[model samples]
Target: MLKLDHIVKDFGNHHGLRDVSVEFPANQTTVIVGPSGSGKTTLLRTIDFLEIPDSGRYQFDDLDYDLSKPLTKQEVLAARRKLGIVFQSYNLFPHLNVLANITEGPVQVLGKNKQEAEAEAHDLLKKVGLDDKADVYPDQLSGGQQQRIAIARMVAMAPEYMLFDEPTSALDPELEVEVLKVILELAKMKNSIVIVTHNMDFARGVADKIVFVEDGQIAYQGDPTTFFNEPNDRIKAFLAAGQFNVK
Candidate 1:
């Protein structure tokens, strides 16, 4: 399980995160949904140590971190490895082929040989339904295929948590389903998966829990059944404004 208490972060011009607290159960999908600039991305970054919080405490499985003090570079990197972050952009090495991109981290960072890493990469490619695209470069694939490659790269890292920052937001509307399908498969892998997304329909389909954030804070957190069927006025307003088309 992952737990956060009193997370606080301040950007130069904004409250990046504000006294945020939440818990994520193991082997479950937790979707953080809200408007743009609502601190959903910031919260995920802090958990992965991309953004340092001014104050907070996080418990990830057996590891616990105090965010009140500064963390060293090594400490930050270590934390990041525990929770792999996949962003809006695929961020694959465009110069490299899909197999190379997926195996890069394992060979370089995880101390695995090319053969071993390639084996893992092949398995992940097959898992993401892209086994045939192993030799293709990022430019040769569609947006959704590129995103799946990015996800496969993270799976090779073997992290306990996968932090996704709008993984499908960059794709064309028609291309979104392909990426969402891979995400749904990841959620079923029995790891704690946290995603920040505007895709309400995808969230409802996969998330065991949903969190609504606004103004740098979590306005609500509940099971999907409650969040969709019986939301507070705040959530109702948000859903109405976005016309999320929840079903």
Candidate 2:
């Protein structure tokens, strides 16, 4: 499980996060949905230590960390290892083939033997349904395929929690289905899979719980069923704007 207590981040004049506190339960997936720039990405980044919060307490498994100050190199590395993230862009290395890209981190950062990393990379490729593209470069694959490989690359590290920031936002509608399927498959692994998405349909299908964020704070969060049925005006208005059908 991962918990953020009173998380806050500031950008000189504006606040990126405002006392954001949320918990991602173990073996479950939580979906975060909100308007653009509503602190969704910032929250994910902080959890990954990509953007350290100004102040907060983070609890992961048996560890608890105070985030009010800069973390040491070891601390940052340790935090990053547990929380794996995928960005809107696939962010694949054009110079490497699919298999090579997937194995790079394990062999380099995790210090796994090259042969062992390759074996695991192949398994991950199969998990993402891209086993056939092992030798292909990022430039040779479609956007969806590259994203799947990206997911595989992250998975190779065996993170305890996974974070996705608008994974489908950059894909065309048709391409999104494949990527979403891979994510849903990951959800079945019973890990903490937190996704920030604007695709309401996809969100409804995969989320065990829904978090509605607004203006740098979480406005509402609960089970998916009640979240859709809620009569709160602000939430209702937001859903209406997105044309999301309330379940």
For candidate 1, report its TM-score.
Answer: 0.95
Backbone clashes counted, model 1: 0
Per-prediction TM-score to the true structure, in the order listed:
0.95, 0.95
Per-model CA lDDT versus the true structure: 0.88, 0.88
Which pairs of residues collide in model 2?
none
| Tens-place lDDT digits, model 1, residues 1-247 | 7888999999979898889999987789999998888999888887887788898997777678888977778777766777888999989999999999999999999999999999989999998899999998999999999998999999899988888999988889888898888889888766789999998878888999998889999999989888988887878778878886533
- Candidate 2 has its poorest 10 consecutive residues by lDDT at 225-234
lDDT of 2 at 191: 74
Q: Stretches of candidate 1 above 4 Å error?
A: 245-247
